[model samples]
Target chain A: MAPMSFAGKTIELDADGNLANRGDWSDDLARELAAQDGIAELTPQHWAVINFMRTVFEKDGDAPSIRRLTKESGVDTKMLYALFPKGPAKRAAKIAGLPKPKGCI
Target chain B: MTQTAEPIQKVSIIVSRGSLEGVYPGLIMANGARMEGIEASLFFTFFGLDAIIKKRMNSLKVATVGNPGMHMPTILGAIPGMSAFATSMMKKEIEKLDIPPIGEFITMIHDAGCEIYACKATVDMFHLKKDDFCEEVDGVISVGQFYEKAAGAQIIFT
Candidate 1:
């Protein structure tokens, strides 16, 4: 139940969407994540973007816009959808180890 | 406590053919991953092995009529000159999307940092050497080594 980093906090996944890293959360975001299923992976591409998104968040604590993401990674947009099969921003975000994105559903 | 999870940030795809149909999926996926900000890899093996063959990778073809679609693969095969027609059609569709030809796309993806692998066993099976492959390949690897790299990441057989 302890936070993974130097910070001392624990994220519990028992709730619908308890973040795996509560230390990474803002209070409001933590509560929101708790309201959904923890996180799910329906395909390989989901895992692909989720991993990349985590890196961006780690560097900035904020999710990159899709355009920024493409520019940064140099991958095409259509392919992201091909992998996710579920919407990219909405679904891939959860598995990527990020807080609920601001203004994102 | 939430599950103790590992963080993953990159992806690898395996491409083993130089043919139009066999190689494009891996290239498309690699490019797609790059677009998503994920590091993508393509490992080429066997006849798919041709996808990385420096001279042949770019010249792959769609199997037209005799492909698994039952009636199509053979019917297309029966037509004397239809193979070229099918290849051109495939090329047109890909061009419409602006996807480069198989060779160029592979090069682009590799330059974008998509790790490309040429299987050693397959190379031996086909009697090829590293120089026989395109520059995109990072190294020749065994299936075991491939597993080591692919462990925490997605393993796409395409």
Candidate 2:
């Protein structure tokens, strides 16, 4: 995947453009990636999903799937799509600088 | 002038198996699509009809006999009650994760705006009436109709 350069930090990305190193992630980096994904601004609802996904990844060793997101992220399914369009689990994970979620098609 | 990339607008999943393990992949994929802000649909055919039939949909069992993932040899997998044992284990694991049961999951998918369809040929072959399906079923449709709806959509078969 192409490298993403922002805020004077160049970060490697996986084939799907997720952060190659989790340590490379920051709120700034997430904002940049979210912009590239066509989300111009991160709302409180967006952070709710990103933070929930990152927390789940830290504890579970993988990002949450759609089912987990709807059931455990305190975000309803419709809002999840509105917050992270075209694939919430994948798009949110990418913007959150996490790996692609398993079973995310 | 440059052409911008177009977003995926829809996904169509063809679920052709009736096993407990077989059905979830399609459901998961469809749900994933809706979660992504895409329209989604599921076309159930053949033995997969069991996944929508009101009487059998909720009672799907994991097929251990021909399943290599079961880890048990086929001979041992055939032991009496093994299928039920595997089904119960799967159900327990799913519950442990707070995932809804089959019936509820189906309803959840429908409530989330995923269209559900039963194959007309399969319904006819099984002598099933419309009421025999879960109310979530949008319609009983022929393959031609399904393809018409699936046009320009990403198609997944599981």
Q: What is the DockQ of each candidate?
A: 0.04, 0.31
DockQ of candidate 2 is: 0.31
- Model 1, range B22-115, lDDT digits (tens) per residue? 7777777776666545666778887887777778866777765547743575755767767677788889977765567777677666655578
Q: How high is the TM-score of chain B in model 2?
A: 0.94
lDDT of 1 at A78: 59
TM-score, candidate number 1: 0.56
Distance (Å) between predicted and true CA of A79, model 1? 20
lDDT of 1: 0.63
| True interface contacts retained by model 2 | 0.51
Candidate 2 residue pairs in backbone clash: A87-B36
Best by DockQ: 2
Per-residue CA lDDT of model 2 for B50-72, tens digit only, reads: 88888998899999899999999
Best-fitting candidate, measured by lDDT? 2
